[model samples]
Target: MLKIDSIKFDDEKMDNDRLNNYIKKSEDAVEIFVDLLKMDGQEEVVGMIALDNDHRLIGVLELMRGGDTFQKIGTDDLFYLALRLDADSIILAQSKADGLKVSKEDYQFNEFLIEEADKFRINIHDNLIISGRDYISIS
Candidate 1:
């Protein structure tokens, strides 16, 4: 089983009740995503929010971190972790220096994730690109 500490969100506690209440919509998920990134102090991070069948929070995964320009997300590791966690759906979020802009690669990756999720029997809820205090949903 994966422990919450495995994802290490700085010192902020992962309040299960609050997170569950705040994750019902994409807007709420974006807020949580921004908060998590701010807490982690990462300029560029690719992360995933995993949810169970009923959309309850399972856990969050910090997939990869890189330079402000770009971060590569490993599909194999991502899907393997999702399967291990038994996630029914996932929301992808990435922080970029380019504010609220979804790059071509981001679109391609989101499309690919949707296609791959079908095979994995997992739902791709949304893909968000966040910068500073703003975000744009691409998928």
Candidate 2:
């Protein structure tokens, strides 16, 4: 069984406030989702970017159709390799695509994510997009 797959925001150590400090309500950030596939035993992630109105970047979630769910991987897993620009809020959801729904409280970052899950699409960053990852400083 996969031991970790939560989405509550406070569950893990948030990088720091700087991640989202520059984000403006007047402008919305673009959220990107990456799906890495290993078809011939070689690794390659197929990434999709999600955008909000006003076009600032918001989320940068990763996906895999088989094997590991995003939550099963440690926080640094993707960061060490393929990282999105960065964000005030980066999250992992054990998507229903896998036939799972983690309890709200038991899930980390659940509220922010689930609330935005619907009414969004995968898109790319153009000049108008503001990346949260770009402004945040790590402690």
Candidate 3:
């Protein structure tokens, strides 16, 4: 059996904020990632923004952290997290410190995710490349 721990945003060691809106668009997903996942714009960080069927926030998980090159995401852990969260969909994000442009590897990974997510019956909303304070949706 696998047990997952829950962390409250208001926990003493962590800051908290109230989000009153559902993630209706790519920009909404970008806002959540930028505010919560502070990428230094120096390393490659890949994460998933899990959303419920109503498009409301469920949770965010940093799936993999890599240096300045592409890193393969672990589908086992990724799918497990999504299933545990009961996520209806997820938005994939990666940090490209050099620029906000999507790389060929990015597209390939996105394509691979789409196929994997389909098998899991989870939707892939978008694939975003985040660089510094800017982001572009590659999906």
Alpha-carbon local distance difference test for all models: 0.69, 0.29, 0.72
Question: Which candidate do you rate higher for lDDT, 2 or 3?
Answer: 3
Residue-level lDDT of model 2, residues 1-139, one tens digit each, is 1111242334333345322322332222222211211122123222222224433334444345434333454434433222333322333322222222234433433333334433232222321211222211110
Give lDDT tens digits, candidate 1, residues 1-139: 2234343232443555334422567766776666664513346777788887877667777776777433445676788888888888888888875456666877888888889889889888777887755677888
* Model 3 per-residue lDDT tens digits across residues 9-87: 3322222233433666776666666666666467788778887887766788777677743456577678778889898
- Model 3 has an lDDT value of 0.72
TM-score of 1: 0.78
Q: Which one wins by TM-score: 1 or 2? A: 1
Cα RMSDs, all models: 5.4, 15.9, 5.4
Any runs in candidate 3 off by more than 4 Å, and if so which? Answer: 1-18, 68-70
| Stretch of 10 with least lDDT, candidate 2 | 130-139
Pick by lDDT: 1 or 2, better one = 1
Q: Which of candidates 2 and 3 reaches a greater TM-score? A: 3
